[model samples]
Target: MAHPSSSHSRLFRASLLALPLLLGGAAWAQQPPPAASAAAPAADPGRHMLAEIQVIPRPVGTADDRYKHVDAAIAVIQASGLRYEVHGLGTVVEGPPEKIWPLLQAVHEATLQAGAERTLSIIKVSGGAQAGGPRVEDLVRKFRN
Candidate 1:
């Protein structure tokens, strides 16, 4: 029997190992980033009456991609007199449920204006929940003491 060359053995092991690592990396890359916080309780059951908008603009091939999206979104919301916090996946704007509705509508429009043909949103209302009742600002005010 002939012995395998040392170089050939090393090369064979490298080739075998590379496949799983490459495949694993591809799988990880496909997943979306996680949301910053757990879901807030819906104000009403089966209806999350809050704005959860996502702007999925087509890749613009820019060096500063995030800026393009943020700037566009901010411009649209600001023009409509709404304030927002930029979360990693999207922005979050808080207000009374009624006020939130119109603002969310503007978020949809803003995503459209940002050149996203396919924008998505999850609107739900939550109040009187054990996890944490709504009015995040109120909680903050209480914590200040």
Candidate 2:
């Protein structure tokens, strides 16, 4: 029979040998792959785009009360003077991609800054040519008729 201390020492050595595998190897401490060294091409500021933004904050229950969060988001969109329409599920805004992207970011920040503890923003973007693209009205006018 093996001595108790000898068994314990064997178990300890075994555990030490398993530690690296359990912890995902020593590569965990190694630096990640270097980022792309080349500078990315600059985006064209005049590229036309359409975006739908929906901001949902927590504590959703009552309809009247929940609309305040939606209202807060709309206020930001209104303030930006961008062409937009407030639909049943979300607001659709159209402008240059450069403008619409930043405006979406601002809308999100404004909703949280206004006092929402948590916020979820859903954004859908459609990019098109710099000079022409479908607007919100064009997409929904058929349904309205």
Candidate 1: tens digits of C-alpha lDDT, residues 1-145: 4467977898999988677567786566567888766866445433222344555554421365655644565566566544455557766565445466767677666656666555556544343323334453553566665
* lDDT (CA) per prediction: 0.56, 0.81
Candidate 2 — what's its lDDT? 0.81
TM-score of each: 0.42, 0.63
Highest-TM-score candidate: 2
Q: What shift in Å separates residue 52 of candidate 2 from its native position after superposition?
A: 0.2
**Model 1 worst lDDT window (10 residues):** 41-50
